[model samples]
Target: MTPRELIDVADVPGGPPLRLFRRGGDFMIVLERNELMSTRMHGSEVALGTMACDRLAGRPAAHLLIGGYGMGFTLRAVLGRLGADARVTVVELVPGIIAWARGPMAAVTDGCLDDPRVTVEMGDVAATIGRATATFDAILLDVDNGPDGLTRPANNGLYGNQGLADARKALRPGGVLAVWSASSDPAFARQLQRAGFAVETVRVRARENGKGAMHVIWFATKR
Candidate 1:
C-alpha cells in the first residue's frame, strides 16, 4: 500500500483546523478523524452541480452560487454544463484550501478557479447568501458533512430555519437550492417543505463509476 503523506493544514474560523493528505495520486481533505472530501470520491459532488443545472435547463445565462469549493468537482461539473453566459460564484472560508488547489492539487483543480465565468469569494457563504435577494438561479451547498456542521459549529446555522429562509430569499423565483450530505435527514427534508420549497431527495454514489458509499442530495426549488 502507498503511504499517505501529510501535505498541509488549514485553519477554519470557529472550527478545528483541516489537514490535507496525499497518497500517491489521490488527495484528501480531512477534519480531525473524519475525511471531509477526497479526490477519489467526488461523484455525488459532481451530481450536486449537474443535477441542479438540470433543474434549470432553460436558463442559459443562469447565475449560481456554490458554497465550499471542495476539490472543485462540483464547480467543474457546473462549468461543463452551463453556457458561456452563465455565472458561478464560489465562497470558501478556508484560505489554505484554495492554496492547495492552486498549489499541490492543481491537476485535480483543472484550473476551474481561474474560469472567467466564476468568481471566488474568501468568506463565509452565509454572509454572501444573506446579502443577495432574488439574485441567483441556484445555490449549491456542500460545506459540512451533513446539515449539522461537522466542520464548524457556526455552519450549523446554514441549515437552520432562518438559514433556509435566507436561502429562499436569495434565489430567483423557482431557483433551486441543492444540498449535499453524507446521509439522509428526514427532518431537514420536511423543513424544506415547511420553508415553502418543492423538495426532492436523491441518493447518489460517492464514486463516479456508480460504486462506493451512497450519499444524499436535496434539491429544493423555491416556490
Candidate 2:
C-alpha cells in the first residue's frame, strides 16, 4: 500500500494550517491530523451544490455563494446544475487550496474556476456573507467540518448566532442556506431556527451511489 505524501500546505489565520497530501492518484486535505476532505470521497460535497441549486432551479436570477472550495467538487456540481445566466461566487480562505485545484487537482476540477459564470475569491467566507446585502439566492458552506465540529477557532463565529444572522441577511427573501456536515447536530438546527430560518435536515450517503457513511446537510431557508 502506498502511503500519502505531503505535497503542499496552506497557512490559515487563527486556525490550524491546511495540509495537502497525495497518494497514488488520490489527494487529501487535512487540518492538524484530522482529514478535512478527500478526492475519493465527494458524494456529500456534490450533494451540497446540487441540492441547493435544485431549490433555485427555475429562478433566472440565481446567484450563489459557496464557502470553501474543497477539491472543487461542490463548485463543479453547482455549475452543472445552474443556468448559464446564473453566477457562482466561491470564497476560499486558503489561497493555496485554490491553486492546488488548478494545479494538482485539475482533473477533478475540470477547469470550473475559469468558467464564465464563476468568480473566485481568496478570503474568509464568513466575512463575505456579512458583506452581502440580500445578494445571493443560496449560500452553501462546507467549512470547518460543521457547526458543532469546529476544526478552527476562527470558524466558530461562522456557526455562532451572529454568523447565522449575517448569512440570513446575505440571502434574498426565501433564499436557502445549505451547510454540509460530517454528522448531524440538533443544537445547530435549533440555532438556525432561532436565526429566523426554516430549517430541514437531510441524511445522505457519503457516496453518491448510497454506499458510504451517512452524512448530514442542513437546508435552512431565510424567512
Candidate 3:
C-alpha cells in the first residue's frame, strides 16, 4: 500500500494541524488529527450546493446561509452560481477551517471569501441560525455526516424534530432548505414534512471519478 504524502499544515484551536497535502495529485484538508475533506470527494458537496441554489435561480437579492466550511467547496460553488446581488452567510463551527482555506486550500476557493457579498461567521451553524430572523432565501446544511450526526455528537440535535422546526421558522415564505447526507433517513424526511416543508430527495454521485457511495440530498421548501 502507498502512503499519502504530506504537503502543508494548518492550526486548529488546540494545536498545529495538517491543512493541505498532496497524495499523488489529490489534495486533502486535515483537521484536528482527521482528514476533514479531500479534493477527491468535492464533487458531491458542490453538487448538493448547486442543487439547492437551483431552486432559487430566478430570485434577486437572495440571502443564503451555508452551514459548514469544509474546504470551501460548497461556498465556492454557490458563489459561482448565484447572481451578483445575492448575499451568502457561511457559518462554520471551527475557525481553523477558514484558516485552512485562506492558507492552504486557497486555490479551491478562488478568493470567494473576499467577495463583499460573502459573510464568514466563525461559530456553530445552528447557533447562527437560531439568532437570525426569517430573512433567508435559502439554507444549505452540510454539517456532520447527516441526520445521523457523525462528526460532532451534539450535531445530532440539528437533525432532530425541533431543529427542523427552527430551520423552517428561520426561512422566509417559500424559502428553500437543503441538507446533504451520507445516506437516507426516513425519519428525517418525515420531520421535514411535519415542519411544513415540501420535501424532495436527490441522489448524487460520490466523486469526480463518478464512482463511490450514493449520497442523498434532501431539498425542503417552506410552505
- Which structure among the candidates has the greatest lDDT? 1
Better of 1 and 2 by TM-score: 1
lDDT of model number 2: 0.89
For candidate 1, what is the lDDT?
0.96
User: Of the pair 1 and 2, which is ahead by lDDT?
Assistant: 1
Residue 81 local lDDT, model 2:
93
Give lDDT tens digits, candidate 3, residues 93-158.
767667767866678768989999999988777787777678799999987667855566677778
TM-score of 2: 0.97
Cα TM-score of candidate 3: 0.88
- Compute the lDDT for candidate 3: 0.80
Q: Give the winner by lDDT: 1 or 3.
A: 1
The per-model lDDT (C-alpha) reads 0.96, 0.89, 0.80
By TM-score, rank the candidates, best first: 1, 2, 3
Expressed as tens digits, the lDDT of each residue in 120-183 for candidate 2 is: 9988898899999999999999987888436568888888898999999999999999999998
